[model samples]
Target: MTLALYSGNLLAQSHEWTNLHDEELRRRAVKAAGEKDLPALVSLTTAFLTVQGKSGVLTSPRTVEAYELGVRHFVEFATAQAVNILRPGRHDAQNYINTMLAAGRKPAGVHLKVAAASALYRALRWAGATEADPFREARVPKDPTPGIIKRPPYTEDELADVLDRADTHAKFLLFLTAHAGLRISEALNLHWDDIDEAAKRIHVRSGKGRKDRIVAMSTSLARAARHYRGLYAPGGPDHTDGKRTTPPENVFRYAEMTTARYHLSKAFKLAGVDFRGFHPGRKYAGTRLLRQIKDFGRVAAHLGHESVDTTRKGYASLAADDLKDDLAGW
Candidate 1:
């Protein structure tokens, strides 16, 4: 136990992820928060992300992604209201929130943004920010819309057609996500060295929730990787004679998110399939896995969701017909 504790302390020191006591954390947050300029706010926002990441407070990249979006929204509203969010009052917060509700967006989604903003406030305060939480007195009206939100996954045939039409890189990305349910960031961060062809598994580093886990890759995915590596090698189509022109560490060379979106949109168009956005692939994987096992927990485990309810909320919106066989069994 002593040795293990020592090792744990060493690891924490190496990564600096140890959470400071409330007082010290607040001091650092306040130091980062005092600057109200755009650049300072941006830096503070980034600092919040870093502190959360190091402290294991952030679980998923999506959480970070959502926080970044919320911070941007907060900053814009602060600028418009002539208030610094770090030093905001109830009035400024209400005004900013009013715009969100006025836009006719659903309340649940808006609440997420508000929640993120509140989290930033707490994070800053812990770091020593002296400002009052503007959201303390604010209210986000409840959304009356039915809690269920569902989208149909792409059919196997439609997905195959998309793959057939996709460029090599896009094909790999789309196919992997469809079969393995890898989030786009996970897919993009995939490194060749992480793939275990023999075990048919890939280690997803710091996936959603900042947790590392392994997911099985299909045989076809391995084959596709090998084929792409060959083509993109020194003599392959993507590279020239330059040594520095070696294949990138990432399996897929595509980096721009917009470009991937455009490719998916175009592929769906050419394939004559209904486009339900890139998320359908993940939904398809989760739904199919749930169907086969009839176990929500198992399916959620594969998808890296800590709670089965979250998996159900996000991916359980299936059609009545998909359950015909199971219903018959009953």
Candidate 2:
């Protein structure tokens, strides 16, 4: 059947397209795109992405939000230029790119927006929305500086000071990332069952890129784990109070990443240290391990990195003392 016939039937069945769930919207979008029904295609795709966010297709909520913003920006630009959003020519796409660069948007930010637009086109094409992908060959400048130069890792002493100022819960959170090399999300989602204290190993399930790895915990991390478990774990010796409180499954009780970050930031404030972010703690772990073992491969494994080059490029940086020692020997 023609897309027009399908869209008419779809509209007749549902007065408000926005009310449909992601799956329903997805089906409608495919049909609308196939039929080349401009109004229905625009409405269904917008509703599918902005509201419910192409759930299974997109990896995270952050990506969904970024893509939605990117698409909105592109639509606005197209409208202002009297260009069709779904069928913009190369000239129009180039103009948008030039406009963004002229406005002094950072290279990374521009890349993200362009990538988001590219993703939107991909989805559309998959659903038979359009044959052209303007973003496919668009150029985006690269950020020349290395990540380590931008955000250096926290020193051992600095992390220690933050730990000293932190509460028990906050301390455990820091230990997971700084000492055990867990990502902030991994630490926040960690369950008691994932840890093998005696073995000194942590099984990280579904880390970045949907991959899992075994992370070795440091002595300090193990100590912190035991202490946290005693007071806060589901069935620990000191966990019970007078009333019956249903114990939480995850180790850290904070339900939101922002809340966890707030506590960590407060500790940094009390310790009189700058808050560079949680990833630096993970970097600290990687650098410290590399220093001890003199092996990039092991450090990469510990950091759950699929490539050793990533660990070397981003995590491994020479300590000031190490650099000085090499010069002193000369």
Candidate 3:
């Protein structure tokens, strides 16, 4: 076993990853991965997954969490089989996939777990930890069912009710997505200077796809913004600090997406509405706006989508009730 070679390197650098800061872990991990530093790669991968450092990274928390969960299952399987997890054979990977499927895990879920296991082996190979990638050709069952149905956007009446029940900060967050079509991340990242009350427009900085866009606010959204600003940005968009007057760096009182999501769900419960998630509000904005304007490209731009096709596919599906009036003539 090449474990003999790794044992010597581990003696010197086994504790190195523990001493490094979370921010420094990723840079060192990349270097370790590239230079085939197996001991460093092992420690760094474990450490990086544990803290995940900070926000605004290329990968999202959701993806990281999913991968973590998947890897845990593989670790458990490896332990029971007495297999060298880092040097698993192709049959070991196949059995793991089969076990997950046999246990009634969804096909998609099994696939994701298999993919996570495959990713670990790829890292190991890159770090010269092992040449074996059992998961490389492992067969994962295809999902028999179509993708999960997404929750539909809220109706205008339902959104209005939610707004009425929400307080200051929640109202602004909801309005940003429900009316202005800002993504939850974009909304949370907003600053007072990004809003233009006079022009009824918002400057979304570094939205999805790392693109900046200008979005027009609906009349109702503008009203909500004014009310929110009156309470939160009471400094009138300019605070005199020493000699300079600067807008607040962030518009919302809450900095984290989880905080914003919690408040939105609370408001939904209070309003007696089913709590679906933030995207519904954005879908409402795009779908309603497209209904009024009947223009795909215009609505896509308003939603900060780079392609009109995305806007059309996501927001253009119409229910039978929506077409009742138009079809009545036939």
Model 3 CA lDDT for position 201: 96
| TM-score of every model versus the real structure | 0.72, 0.74, 0.67
lDDT of 3: 0.68
The Cα RMSD of model 1 versus the native structure comes to 7.9
Give the number of the best model, judged by lDDT. Answer: 2
**Residues 105-182, candidate 1, lDDT per residue (tens digit)?**
667778888876776676566456665787888888865432335356677788888888877767777866776788
Give the runs in model 2 whose Cα sits over 4 Å from its true position.
1-83, 91-105, 236-247, 319-330
> In terms of TM-score, which candidate is strongest?
2
Expressed as tens digits, the lDDT of each residue in 109-188 for candidate 3 is 78888866665565445344457778767787665442313447788889989989998768888889988988888888
Candidate numbers, best lDDT first, in rank order: 2, 3, 1
Tens-place lDDT per residue, model 2, 94-162, is 778888989988776788778666765665654444677888777877777766666679988899899
Clashing pairs in 3: 90-134
- Ten contiguous residues minimizing lDDT sum, candidate 2: 1-10
Evaluate residue 295 in candidate 3 and report its C-alpha lDDT on the 0 to 100 scale.
85
